[model samples]
Target: MDPHPPPPPQPPNNPVFPPQTPNGPTIALRPQMRPTSTLRPQTFAGSATLGMCRMKEWWLQVGLLGVPLLAVYLHIPPPQLSPALRSWKSSGSFFTYKDLNIFYRDSSGAVGSSDIVVLLHGFPTSSYDWSKIWEGLTQRFHRVIALDFLGFGFSDKPRPHGYSIFEQATIVEGLLRHLGLRHQRINLLSHDYGDTVAQELLHRYEHNKTGSILINSLCLSNGGIFPETHYPRSIQKLLKDGGLLSPIILRLMNFFFFSGGLGAVFGPYTQPSQAEYWDMWTAVQNNDGNLVMDSILQYINQRKKHRERWVGALMSTSVPLHLIYGPLDPVNPHPEFLQFYKKVLPMSTVSVLDDHISHYPQLEDPTGFLNAYLNFINSF
Candidate 1:
C-alpha cells in the first residue's frame, strides 16, 4: 500500500453551537445596578415622583449601554488555535461525514513494518492528546492514525447530534475506509472515551458486523470501561442528570476550572504547565465548544447503557489485548476498574505506570508509556 496517498477532500467550514437555545430573552436578563446614594426629596411638591422618574431613566440608559457590550461578550469569537493544534492541522487534513467535518492525522511509519496503529483519544480532549506519542509511534510502526471524534477537539461539534459510541465507531471505520485501510490489519491504542469506541469496533469486528477491517492487537489505557465501578466528575453527573441547572453549569466553566480540572486528573507529582493548560483550554473553546460540554458528556450515559456489549467485546475478542494503567487516575481509579479487566482477560498484558502517574500516562510519562506499548505489541 502507498504510504503517501492523496489527501481526502475537505469539508465546508461551519460553526459549532449549543443544541438547546438559552431560555428567556437574552437581552432582558441584564443585572440591575445598585444606587450610589439615596435620592433626597426635592423642594417641589412632586419631588418624590421626580426622583422615581430619574431612577427609571437611569436604568434605561444603563441597559442601552450594557446591551451592546453584552452582545459583544456573548458573541465571543473562536479562540486562536494552539501551536500543537496548528501544526497537527498543517501536517494533516479533514474529511466529510454526514455533513460534519472530522479532523485526522495519518502519518506513515518506518519502512518494512506491516503494523497500522490507530490512536483514540479520551473525552473533553481532541486528537491533539496524542501529540506526545505520535512521532514516536510513527518511527516504529508502519502507520499511525488519529482523529478528533465529532463533538470533541477540531471535529465539528454538532449539538442535537447523535454522540453515541457506536456512531463514533462508525466514523472511525469511515476514516479507515477513506484512507484505504478497511481490509487492513489494525492495532488499536485508545484512552478514556476512545476506549469505548475501540471496544465497540472490536465487538462488531469479532461478530463480522463491520466491514473488512481486521484487528491484529489492542491496547487500552485508563477509561471507565466498567461504568458501574467508575466515578465520574461532579459536573459530568450534573450534565448527565439533564436538569434545568445544566445550562448554568456549562456557562460557569472557565479557564481556571477547566485547567484545574485537567490538573486534578494527573498524579500529585505531575502538574501541567500554564502554557500546556492554556493550549488545552484554547482547543476546548474553539468554535464555542464550551456550549456543547453537556451534550458531548452524554458518552457517560452511553457507557452505562451499553456496558454489556462493550465489556463483552473486551473479553471475547480473539486478538491479543493489553492494558496500560495509571493507578492514581482520579476519575477512573485503577483499583476499581483494573480488577475487572484482569478478571475478564487473565492472559492479556497489563502494565502499571506506578509512582502515581494518574489518568494520562502518555502525557505524564511519555517514555514509559511508549516503551510499554512497544514491548506489548512487539512481544507477540
Candidate 2:
C-alpha cells in the first residue's frame, strides 16, 4: 500500500468485436455511419447541375427587371417646347428639301448694308445657337440667315438614312435656293459641325460645282476643321463607334446627359441657364432628333476621311477667310490648333479670344466674337 500496488486481475479470454455474418464481413454501425436522414450525398455532376440552374435563375431575374426598365426609358415622352423655344419656332419657317422640311430664319436688317451673312450651326444643336449673336449680326449686315440642317433643330429627323457633311452642304444650298438667294454671294459664319459643312460648301464653290452657294467670305469659330488637331469627347467617340449600342444610348439620352455633355464645351463662367438647357434639350427631343445623333456624329469620321478635301478647300480658297478661336477649346485646343492653322493657311487671318473662353465662343463672349468678326469683315 505504501510503495507499490498489486497488478489488476485479467478478464476471461473473449475478444470484444462485432459479430460477423456468415456471408459477409462484419460492419460496425457507428453513430456517423448510421443512416440519420434520407438525404443522399451530392455527386459532382449533381452539384454542377444545381449551379447551372441557379445561374439561369439569376439571369432570368435580371432580364425580368431590365426589360421593363428599358421599355420605360425608351417610351419616355419628349419634353414640351418651352415658351422661348416655342417663340423661336414660331419666328422661323420651314423650307422643303426633297420632301424633308428644313427649319430656317431669315431676318432683314440694316438697310444700309447689302451684305448677307448665313450661319451654319453645329451638331446636336440648331440655328438657335446663333440667337446670341443674331441681333449683332443683323445690325451690321443687311440680311442674316440661319438654318437647321435636315436632322437638326426643328427639322425632320428621318431614320435609316445616311447623314453626311456632303448632304448637309447640299441642304444649305437647297435652303438658299428655296429662298431665291442661290446666286447671291453669301458671307458664311459657321461653328463646329457647321464648320465642316462650310468647308464642303467652300469646296464646291472653289471647284465650281453646280448648285453651290457663292461664298464671299467664311468665318469659322471653335470648329473641328483639322481632324488631326481635334479631340472628340469620350461620349462622342463612343456614340460614333457604338454600332449596336448606339440605338440603346440614343434612346436613353435624357436632358441631364445632354446638358452635361453640352455644358462641358462652354466656358466655366458662361454656362447656359437651366431654361436655355431645356430649350436645347427640347430641340433635340423634337422629331426624335436624339435618335439621329450617332448618325450625325459620323461626320467626325467623314472629316478624317476627307481631310484633304475640307482643309484643302480652306487653304486654296481665294475668298477672304478668318478664324475666331476660343483659346481654351478642348475640341480644338489652343497653340497646337492655332499654330497648325496658321501654318496651313498663312493667308487667312485669326482672332484669338481671351484665355478663359472655350468652345461656343460666340455664346461665351458674343461682344468679343462679334467685334472680332466685324473687324475681319471690315478689313476686306
Candidate 3:
C-alpha cells in the first residue's frame, strides 16, 4: 500500500462528502447552486445617497448646536465700565468729528512750561494707556492731551466705515483746531498704532498741508513704523485678513482672550495685574469697540502701503525726533527693529530702555518711559 492514498470517489452530483467512520454517522454533501436572498445588491448610487444623507445629518446637528451658541455670543452684553474707567470717562469730554463723537482728555498742567504734549495711544487700546504716566507728564508740560481715536475707547465705533491713518491724522488736526491750538507748536508723543498716526501728522506738517497742526517735536515708541521689521501677532494677522472669521472672533472676544493676548506682549516680570487687565478689557468692551478692531487693523496694511510718506516724514523733517523703545517687544523685536530704525532714522535720538521692558513700555516701565520722554523734551 502506498504511504499516501487518494480520497475515495464521490457521486457526480456531490463533489465532496465526509468519510464514514467505524461507529460515527456519515455526513451528507449538497450539490453547489446559486443562493437567492431578499436583500438588494448595493450600488454606487446607493452608496452616494447614503453618504449624502450622513453629511446632511452631520450639518443639521452642527447647525442645531451652532446657531444658539452664536446667538448667545452675539447677544452677550459688554462689560460694565470699571470705576476707574468711569472716572476716566467722566473726566474727559467729547468733541464732534463729523457726526461721530470723539473722546479726549485735556489737562492744564504745569504753568511754568509752555510745552503742549499730545498723546496718541496704540491699537486696541485707548488713551487710558497713558494713565500711568499722565500725572508725570502733567508735572512737566503746561498742557497734556490724549484722545481715544475713532473706534477706540469711549469713541464712536462706527461700523462699515473706512478707518485709516490719514483719517486719524485729520481727526487730530480737527481736535487741535477745535481747541484754538492750531497755531501753536506742539509735541507729539505716540506709541504702537499712534506712532503711525503721528507720522502722518508729521508728514502733513512738513508738507504745509492746510489746517495741519504745528509740531514742536515728535517721539515714537514701539510702533510698526517700519513694516519690514514689524511682526504682528497671530491673532492680529488673522483679524486683519480673517474676513468672515474676523466677525466671529471679535464677537467671541472676552476678558480671558483679551488679557492672555495682551499679556503675552509684556515681559515675564512686567505683566499687568488682574485689575489692570480688567480695566483694559472694560475700555475695549465700551461702545462695542471690539467689533471695530478688524477695521482698525487695516492700519497694518496701510503702514506698509504708505511707508514712504510716514518714514520719510521722520527722515527729512527738521523737527526734533526721538524713539523710546522696549527691546523685548515681540511685535517689533530687538536687533531687527532697532537696527532698521537706527539705520533709517539716524538723525532721530534713541532711548533704549532695560532689556526686560517690552511693548507698552509706558505701562511696563512708566518711570523709565517718562524719564526718557522728559529727557528728550529737555534736550533741545
Candidate 4:
C-alpha cells in the first residue's frame, strides 16, 4: 500500500464558457451567482419596453438561458458496490423498515445481552465498509447492525427524489422501531456522512413516537463535521456550481471512475491508504449527484455546521461520548473542536490514532479503532 496521499484537486483553469459553434452545444457565458444584492447585470433590452410599449411576445429558451439555476441539492448516493456474497462475511438476520433493508449480526457475548452497536457508512461506501470492525465486535455485543442507508448499499435508489440527511435519519429510526430494538439505549458508531445523519437522529430522538432507544454513546471517526474544515475541493466546487466547464468535468470523472486502472487516484484524498480505496470510491461514482446533494445540505443548509447542536445533544443526554480520530487526516476535526464538547459535555473522551487511519479509521487501523469503540461502550 502506498503511503503518500493523492494530489490535491487541480485548480479549475477552463473558461466559464466554451467556444460556440454554429451547430454545436449552446455556449452561454453566465457567471453563477448565488443570491446576492450586488449590482445586477446590465439589462440591454432595457427599461425602454418596461414603460413605453406593451410587449405581447413571450420567450421561453433552453434550460440554461439567463434562467437562474434553481437547484435543490440532495444527498450523494453510495457507490453501488456489489456484496461480496449474499451470505454475510460475519452473518446476521435480514429485515426492513420503511424502505431501508437492514442486516443485523448478532453479537457473541454479553455485549449482545444488554446493549447493541449500530454502525453506519457515509457517501460512496456501503455498510460493507463496516465488515472489518463488525467482524471484531459482533462477538462481544448483543447485536451489531450495519444498516444499508436508503440509496446506499443494496438499498433502493429512486430517481428525481431527494436524499437529505434528515430523511435518512428518519429511515434509520424507523428501522430500529420496526426491529423491536426499543426502550434500550444503544451505542452509535458513524463515519463520514453517517455522522451527520446520526446527529440528526439523536437530536430528534426525544420526539420519537416509538421511543425505541437513546444514543448511549457517540463514536465518530472521519466524518464531515465542519464544511470549512473539509471545504470542497476545486473539482467539487466547480461541478456543483454547474459552470459551463461542469459537463466536461463530469464526463471526465465518469471516465476515470468507471475505469478500472488508477481510478483510485482520488481515493487517498480523503484518507490515503491503499489504492484499493478507489475501488470503493468509484462504486457510487454514478449515484446520481449524491455528492452534490450532500454538499448542498452540508454546506448550504447549516446541517454541516451543526457541531454545536450535535455537542449540545450529547450534553443533554447522560450518555457517554467518545471521539476516535485519525490524526493524520487534518480535515477530520482537530482536538480544539473537542474542547467545545468539553465545555458542555462532562462525560466525553477523545482518542487519536496517528497511524494510517485517515478519515476512515475503522478501515485504516481497525485494531486501534475497535479498541477505542469497545472502551467507550464499557465506560457507559
Candidate 1 error regions (>4 Å): 1-70
lDDT of 1 by residue, 90-202 (tens): 88889999989998999998999888999999978888888898889999999999998888777888866557888898999999999999899999999999999999999
Q: Candidate 4 on 1-380: residue-level lDDT in tens?
A: 77987865543534564445546676666666556434343343456556344442233443344345322212334344345433443355556755545444444554427677888787556676776777777766777777766665455555435567767777777667766776667788998778777777777764453543577777776666544455433344555566456545443454344343222322254443333454455434534433333333333244445667754565675556677777655444455444444565456687877644565677767788888888777775
**Per-prediction TM-score, please?**
0.82, 0.86, 0.86, 0.63
Q: Across residues 85-105, which tens digit of lDDT does each residue of candidate 2 receive?
A: 888889899988889999999
Better of 1 and 3 by TM-score: 3
- Lowest summed lDDT across 10 adjacent residues in model 4 is found at 258-267
User: How much is the lDDT of residue 36 in candidate 2?
Assistant: 38
Task: For candidate 1, give the lDDT.
Answer: 0.83
Candidate 1 residue-wise lDDT at 213:
64
After TM-score superposition, what is the CA distance of residue 184 in candidate 4 from its true location, in Å?
2.8
Superposed Cα deviation of residue 214, candidate 4 (Å) = 2.6
For model 2, what is the C-alpha lDDT against the true structure? 0.91
* Predicted structure 2: clash tally: 0
